[model samples]
Target: LAAGCRTERATSVCLLRVFSVCVCHPEEKKSVPSDEPFRVVFRNFQRTLARPVLLGQGEAGAARGTLQVSRHQDHPEVCVYVDASSTLPFVPPKTCAFLGPLFPPLFSPIASFLPSESHGVVLILDGIIQCTERDEFAYQEMISFLPLCCHPNPQRVLIVGGGDDGVAREVAKHPAVLEVHQVEIDERVVELSKQYLPFMACGFESPKLKLTIGDGFEYMKQHEGAFDVIITDSSDPIGPAESLFRESYFELVKRALKPNGIICSQGGSFWLDAGHVRETLDYCRKHFPRVTYGLAAVPSYPTGQIGFFIASLNPETEFREPARQFEDAEIDQLGLRYYTTDVHRAAFTLPRFAAKALNP
Candidate 1:
């Protein structure tokens, strides 16, 4: 039995013959015959380990368990949470190819993309979550669908930030959308997302989509009254996105939107940062006549929720009921994981505490 290990860049790739060495659960030890020719592949990641590696399958095709790796060296070294008693056939999990690191932790979010082990593909910019693949549906579906659905015919849409996630794809899902122009600050996020997170990268391939590698603030400053719907998928109300939550930015957003336009933005969490939500809405409400808030359950977000600050030029436009309704069948056809007509309306019906904090 022979073994070889190679280190490249920030990753370690170990190749071990079936007979000699393998990492797995200690209790379920299965001795490997010295003659088998199968080779097992193991990879270690620096910066972050975005995918899980499953192991311990014998010739009998029986499953043993799974292994999860993390970039946080301070955390547990090995944690296997998969059911061990179930005797199911061996099935390889979805293979998430490691593209590279996600944003530069200490600096800007200009790096590679990698799928998270538990939380789908994850983007951590400045140590804050930009998006979590598994839970992003809640934010993507709501942020993209809410304002677009509110408009009678949202043909031209503008997406600010959220280059690495599926926000553009969600906007393009609407049949009425003629063009989707996305202005993302970091091109590396888009490039890496397209390579590692294919599910979120679908929007980049759309014929109606035009991606602009630039700043959303500058993009809005240059364009005015051109969009029917504007969705701000910016990160937390800090760092590069701190200005996005300011009244001056909304002033630009108001100018960029059509007369009857609507805008929706990532408005922080009510339970975690109610003050941030209130302050953002205060800024948005000054530019638009009608303004409100909405929320979606995303476990990755603080307090198991993510909020959206919604505003409309027309006071008659209610953020509750959508202008365009979709049947369950149509939703299925569009492959929408979340954001239904009911969910859109119900998302605004917040708890009393949130209602007082945001609305008051």
Candidate 2:
């Protein structure tokens, strides 16, 4: 038996053979074996020796383990999990191709055209918008129309944090929404979404839509008691979005709405981020007269559960069922793949734990 090793990249694999070493050249060398069964191993791009096996190999190629990898469109440095199958398409665990770094981080905007783990591909018209997690349209629809539908007659609406134009598209659907003003902090998110994600931003070109590039909190403070419905379509409480989740922001939202106005804001997920949801709910209860927790199942989001906090200045709000009637009609007409009348009702159904946290 002859022992020889081959190095590829930074790792080397050993191929066992009986009576080998027929040719040995540094640049071009071929291992020759004299009539004997041998083993060959391919160099793995990533180290999988210690990584947890989601699935592992079994007897007789029993199809137990799998690995798959794809480049994330938004952030390329990050690798994404494409699929894991025992047969072909062996995907590496926890590797996503993130396309975000391909362009300049400050101004480069990327829109996901193919629906991945996050939002459906939509074009960003003005500012930089990126879907970190969750289905973009599911959350966008609720943020746009929830407060719009809650009010008896919503004429002027303001949306904060949805620069990707998905919320703007939904807000333009209602005839009663005479004017929809969207203030986004980043202009690249909107411009990128418009170029790449057209379907997700369906009606953003409407005449009633007004795009403003500014800080949403400062913008709201300047326009007190101006909007009939104020929708905060912000991201999770991290990075630049931390301020949006605070009591100060909620107070601004309250001040920006009319006397009997309704404000619905994205409050994170009730399933996984319960503590954050509870904190936001409690903040709303203190600031607004009517505070209700609603849920929406967005497949793109983790845990498949999303939530919204509806706060009304007037406790006597007439929460009307959607005039379009989501129950009996085909959900496609509503431009939704997740939200339904059942979901709408169930989202408001709080478990004892969450209810106690909010009410207490």
* Cα lDDT of model 1 by residue, 108-201, tens digit: 5333334544566665442235566677777788889989999999999999988765889888889999999999887867777777678788
RMSD of each: 11.9, 13.0
Q: What is the TM-score of each candidate against the true structure?
A: 0.70, 0.65
Off by over 4 Å in 2: 1-88, 91-135, 318-343
Clashing pairs in 1: 50-115
Give Cα-based local distance difference scores for all models.
Answer: 0.67, 0.57
Tens-digit lDDT string for candidate 2 (5-64): 223322212222122223223343332322323433333322111111111111101132
The numbered model that scores best in TM-score is 1
Lowest lDDT sum, 10 consecutive residues, model 1, at 51-60
How many steric overlaps are in each model, in order? 1, 49
